[model samples]
Target: MADFKELSRLLEEILEQGPAGCGCAVARNGEILFEEYHGVKDLESGEPITADSVYRQYSTTKVAVCTGAMMLLERGKFLLNDPIYEYFPEWKDTMVAQPEEDGSYRVRPAKRPILIRDCFSMAMGIGYGGTDYTHQAAEKVRAQLRANVGEYTLQQEIKAMAEVPVAFDPGTHWLYGFGHELVAGLIEVVSGKGVGQFLKEELFEPLDMKNTGYHYFGDIRERMVTTYLLKEDGSREASPYFQRDELFEPEAKYEGGGAGLFSTVRDYLALTQMLACGGEYQGRKIMGRKTIDLMRCNQLNEQQLKEFRNPYLEGYGYGCGVRTLMDPSAGVNSSVGEFGWTGMLGSYVSIDPAEKLSLVYMHNLFPNREAYIHPRIRNIVYGVL
Candidate 1:
């Protein structure tokens, strides 16, 4: 067992110096080493955060959704190179890339078809932010989708997605937005079930992740943390998008694959543990070892990895999740080959296969203060080990 006192101390200093709420958990080789929580869930109500507290996982949900998709892949339901249009006819030869101005450069048909591997590589032609021509075109399509369809449902949203122009040819460059959600939709189409239903049957049930799902309900609402956003003055405000009681409701406004799902630290740890164990947990084989191997291996080439690099991610590659490609020599103390991702609300999970280690941090505060906390937490834990 590893001593996590240093990890706890770092987390404490982070809370004292930064925000007022935080939670963290550390697990290794399928066993939890330590878990901690600090501060209030609701400042006004004085509700304290605990191990069971659930928070919106944002993009962290991508890993779960991707894992679920991989299970289907292992079962031989679909091949990685299979054209995405085969699953959804509407996607067939439907992608068109908008080009730079001047009649010489204009929109063109995709050279290759969108495939399952493209989704994993985030090269499926969708992005959240940019001012480039492709990004501008994608944004316009998103706007049109929202305008035509008032909600982001699977059927409705996918129809709208089909209408959007491709930002690049399939399997070309990486862009992160809506690709995972589209994967969820495709799962629904292929499995003849809803995304939530498929996950429940294929993942949550097998892993005994009782509190993990697309939406919380009934008594689970009591343990749900209120989402927050950072105000201009550095104060936190409740997010307008997530109401205090929305978790209890059965009908959700949208099935957001990219930025949805609420889970407790322990629940998410179970999912990550499964990955660390090469897709088996508690004697059940959720996915074959080979499939898990594919997920952890670098899916992007050096050039593609360079294109997706951002300030937040230095030497990294897109594995099933964010993967550190280089050692922490330049900065970032995490081990090379570490793979994981963070949520918009300060939640994070990372798996160091080399060390047989995993770390999970869950929080509800926004304008995420991860930069201040992640390094300290890594240093403390790595130092002890």
Candidate 2:
């Protein structure tokens, strides 16, 4: 058995360092073994963190979006290899950026059309504003996205991506950009419903994830935690770009499947538990066992793995919007087949099928991603186990 006391202590150590607050839970065989909350939700009001505290999910939203895409795949709406141009014909003529000798770039026709699986594997050449350094073509796309973060609709964003050149041919390289956003658009195309609606009907309702959604409502606004940024000198301040008031959008102009959602730790736990249980939670089937099996397995090749560069994901492989434990020794004491992803802010979830365990740690901090938190938590959990 894992040392619940020690695990709590380890988390307390992190909270001691000053991150607004955090909520964490560990489960095995769909039963909560250890769970805790620490610190205050909002420093201004001094409200305590609770199980129902809503958190900005950031990139962790990809997992849920990708899950919905897998459900679409299971329904035979489209094959993995099918050209996505059918849904968004504007992408049919997209180009890859080729560098020129004059410190410029030339746009060239893509060797092949983007495949549906490319989105899941993150092998799609699409990129975001955050990764402008990856390629000149991506820089252009990033610039556009940055300028119009909330102005564009999901479909408009997809169209905008098509206009920008790609860094490489689809499926030839791994680039974690706007692939999940495209996946959300694809889901909309097939399901004939908004991404949020589809998730609510297919996932939240069935899983009883009452506190999970693309936007907040009612008392949820009160419980929403404030996000912060821990400076190099250890002082903390609220993130200017991601304030609580900014999140209160009257309507979601861009339900970015890549990075836009709010969820509670317990609600996220239910989702992870479903994944750990092989697509079933409390007798309700969210997805097939084989589909969950496919997600936990590595989907990247040697070249794709080599090209995937991120310190946090150093020893991981891309699966369906989640990181697969490709090397047990290379990761944070993670066993092989452990699959999950972290939010841009400090939030993580990994379901280890080998141990029949699910772990969720969430906090609202922007610049303070707490690089050591995920691995430390993993080590503590596995150490006690």
Best by TM-score: 2
lDDT score for candidate 1 against the true structure = 0.74
Writing each residue's lDDT as its tens digit, candidate 2 over 1-385 gives 5577888887778876657789999998888998999888988888999898888898888889888888888999988888889889988886887667886676789899888888878887866554332354455664677687745678876876677777778888887777888899999999999898899999988989898887767677778888888877877787757654454465646687888888999998999999888888987878997988887677788889988746777778888889988777665686888899888788899888777789999997766555678887888888877
Please provide, for model 1 over 176-289, each residue's C-alpha lDDT reduced to its tens digit, 9 standing for 90 to 100: 776787788777877888888888898988999899787666567788777777666767777857433453357775665676788888888888888877777877888886
lDDT of each: 0.74, 0.82
Judged by lDDT against the true structure, how good is candidate 2? 0.82
TM-score of each: 0.89, 0.93
Question: For each candidate, C-alpha RMSD in Å?
Answer: 2.9, 2.5
